[model samples]
Target: MTTTSEHTQSVATATPSRMLRYLPASALLIDAALMTLVGLVAIVGRRELDVFASSAQVEDQLVLAGPLMIVGWIATVALLGGYRRDVFGVGTDEYRRVLNASLLAAGVTGVVCYLARFDLSRGFFLLAYGLGVPSLILGRMALRRALHSARRRGLLRHRVLIAGSRAHIDEIARVLGREPWLGYEVIGALTPEYDLSEETATGVPVVGNADEATSLAKAYNADSIFFAGGAVGSSSQFRRAIWELEHESIQVVIAPSVTDISNERINIRPVGGLPLMHIEPPTWSDASRWGKRLFDLAGSLFLVLVFSPLFAFAALSVKLHDRGPVLFRQERIGKDGGRFACLKFRTMVVDAEARLNSLHEASGHSEGLFKMKDDPRITVPGRWLRRFSIDELPQLFNVVRGDMSLVGPRPPLLREVESYDVDTTRRLHVRPGMTGLWQVSGRSDLTWDEAIRLDLYYVDNWSMLQDISILTKTLGAVVSSRGAY
Candidate 1:
C-alpha cells in the first residue's frame, strides 16, 4: 500500500516527531554546556592560569584541562544514570543525581590533579563547584517547568496502554488523568475480556483483552504498558509479559494493590529466586523527629524576626478596631492529644465565641469541623488578615516554643478532636504545623475526606524535601487566597 516517494515523505514528517522523545536528553546536554561555561568563567575570573609558572604555560595547560573537566563531568552524570528516561521531567531524583555527579566529579578532579602534580587554583575549583551545582539545578527546574507546561498542553507525554481488569484500568486511568504532570497519555486500555462497548471510568476506550496487550500496544504505538492490580492471570504470566514488553522496548509499570505508600519506604528484594517487596514502617525515629524540631525552631524563629514589623502593625490595627485584646488564644489539640494555646491575631469580635451556638445551623460545617465562608463576627481588619493568612503568623511563636512544626497536619480544635475516630487520631502522631499539606492544597475549601487523605499522605511520607516543597507552595496559596475566608 506504500509507494517509495510517499514513504520518504512520511519518514521526513516522522523525523521531528521522533526527535521530541529526546527533548529531556537535549536539555541535559544543554545543562552540561552551561555548566562548562560557568566553570570557564570561574577559571578566568579567578586568574587560575596566572597562578602557575607563566601565563602562557598555564594557558596551555588549561586548554587541555578545561575540556577534560567538562567531559569528565558529563561522563560522571551519564555514569550515575542522570540521563535515564524515567528520571527525566519529574521528581527530585534527577536533581539529586546531578548534585551527586557534580560532587563526585569535583572530588575526582581534585585527586587527579594532585596526583598528576598539576598546578590548579583551589579557589577556582571551589567557585566552579559552588556555582555549577546550584546553577545546574535551577536550570533543570526551569526545564522541568517548561516540560510541565508542554505536557499540560497535551504535548511531550508517553503514549500509555493500560492492561488490567475493568476496575483496575479505571482506577489507574483516574489517577493518571488527575496527575497530568506525570506525563502519561492514556490512549486506551486492554482489559481482560472487556465488552466491545466498555470504557474506563475516565472515558478511556477498551481496545482489546489483556492477552492481546502487546499487539494493541504496537498498533497504538504505546510507549508504556501499565499493569494494575490483578491485571494478568498469574505471576508467571505477568513476568513473561513484562519480558516481552521489555524486549520491544516498551516500559512496564506495575501498580501493586498497595495504596498511599511512598517509594522511599518500599524496597524490592529477591529471596529464594522470588522478587518480594519489603515495606519499611513509617519513620518515627528520634533522629528524624529531632531534625524536624530543629528545622521548625530555626525556621519559625527566623520568620518571627522577619515579620515582627507586620506583627506590630496587625496588633495595632486589631487594637484600634476594637477595644479588645489583639492576640486571640484558643486551646487546640496537639501531638499525642496534648492541649496547647494556639495563638492568632484577633480576627473576630471579642464575644464571637458566645454566638457560636446561634450560628451553628447556618455555618454549613456543623459536622465536627467548623468553617464559614462569611461570618458576621469578623472585624474589618481581621477579614483582610485572614484573607492573606497573616492572622496565622502568630503561630510561628508556637513553632519556636515546640508546640508545632513548619509543616505537618493542621491542628484540630478540642471539640473536633473529640469526634475523631481511631484512624483520624493518627494525625496527632506529629506536631501540627503553621502551614501544611492541607493549608497549601485547598485550605478551607477542601472536604474533610480530602483534607484527611492529604494529611495522612504527609504523615506517611514526611521528608525535608517535601516540607520545603509545601512551604514554597504555601506562599502561592496565600497570595491566591483561594478558599481562605
Candidate 2:
C-alpha cells in the first residue's frame, strides 16, 4: 500500500505517462504526408504555374514551396486542436475541425501569396485545397477507425479509477464495460467512507473509500478519475479533492447520473458562480410527428426513385423462386395503436406466418421479439434479399403512404404489441420506421429489451438531425450486414 504522504508527493510530481506519447508525432506526420501528396497531385494536374521570384522553373519553385505548404497546413491543424485525444474520440467534431483548419490554411496561403507577390497558379491552389481538405478528413476517419480498433483490443486505454456510491460506480462501470472501444479501462473503485465493501455489485474491486480518492488515484497512476454520486460528502469535499489532484496529469470527469441523452439537449448555465447543468425535455408532440412525416415523405420518394431498379430485380427474383406475390404486406402496429400494412419483398415461404408458433416452440424463444438464426421457412431468394436488406425495399412505399416514417421505431407485429407492458407501449408514440436505431445498432441480433430501449429512446427524443444521422448509418449497416440474419 502506498502511504498517504507518498501519494501526496507523487500527485504533486506526476507527469504524463508513456501511453500514447507518440500520438502527436503520428498525427503531425500523417497530416504532412496527406498535404504533400495533394500538393504533388495538384502540380501534375496543373503543370502551368507562375515563377517564384527569380526562379523561372516551375519544378524548382515547387521543390522549395511544397514542403513549406505542408508544414504550414500541419501547424494550422495542430493550432486548432484537431489532434486532441478527447475531440478525436467519439464524434464528428474531429472531422469538422480538420476541415475548418484546412480551409483556414488555404485562406491564409492565398492571402500570404497575394500580399508577398508570390505568383502562384490559381488552378494549382484550388486543386490542392479542394482535394487536400477532403483527403485530410478521410485520413482522420481512417485513423479514428484504426484507433477505435486498437482500443477494442485494450491498447491505448485510459487507466480509470472510479469514486462514488456502489450503485453509481457500478452503473458507470457497466457502461464502460459495454463500450470497450471508448478505451476506458476501469482499474478499481473508491466507495463512500461509510461503506466497507470489497467490491461493487458489478465486481469492480473497491480500492479505498471516498476520502482516500485523491491518494488512491495517484497511487494507481490513474490517467482518468471519475467522480459519481456519493463520491464526495459535500461540495467542499469535491472541491478539495479536485484541488489536491490539480497538480497531477489526470482528467477529472463527473459522471454520476446522466445516460442515453444526446449532447444537443444538454447545456450549462452559470448562476451565482455555480455551473448548473440543464437538460431539455424530450421532443414528443403531434407537430413534431408531422415534421418527421414530411421528412419521411421526401426521403422515401427519393429512395424509391433511386432504388427502383433494385425493387424490380428483387420482386422478380422472389416471384420466380416461389411463384408467390412479390410484395408481402403484413399488418404491423403503427403509431398510437394504429394498424398499417408493412411491406417487404417476399423473403419467406407462403406459410411463414402459420409456422411462427411452431418455430417459436422449437427454438424455445420466449422473448417478445421473435428471431431465429436459420429459420426453415425462408426461400432461396429471400435468404439473399435479407442479407443486404433488399427485402426492406418495399417499405419505401410504406414511408410514402404515411404508414411509416423514414426513421422511427421498427413497425411491430400485433402479437409483439400485445405483449407490451406499460413502458414498452411508449414505442408506439411515434410512427414505425422502415429503418431506425434498431436497424443501425445490431438489427436482428439485438435483444428484445435492447431493441425496446433503443426504440423508446428514438420515440422520446426525436430529432431531424438524429434521423438523418441514423439514415446515413443505415447504409453502412446494410452493407456490413452486421447482426442481420
Backbone collisions counted per model: 0, 0
Candidate 1 lDDT over 441-472, as tens digits, reads 78998888878878887777777888999999
TM-score of each: 0.84, 0.89
Candidate 1 residue runs with Cα over 4 Å from true position = 1-20, 48-59, 111-118, 194-197, 200-204, 247-249, 284-291, 350-377, 400-402, 479-483
Model 1 worst lDDT window (10 residues) = 8-17
Question: Which is the leading candidate under TM-score?
Answer: 2
Clashing pairs in 1: none
Q: Give candidate 2 regions above 4 Å deviation.
A: 1-18, 48-65, 284-291
- Global lDDT scores for all candidate models: 0.80, 0.82
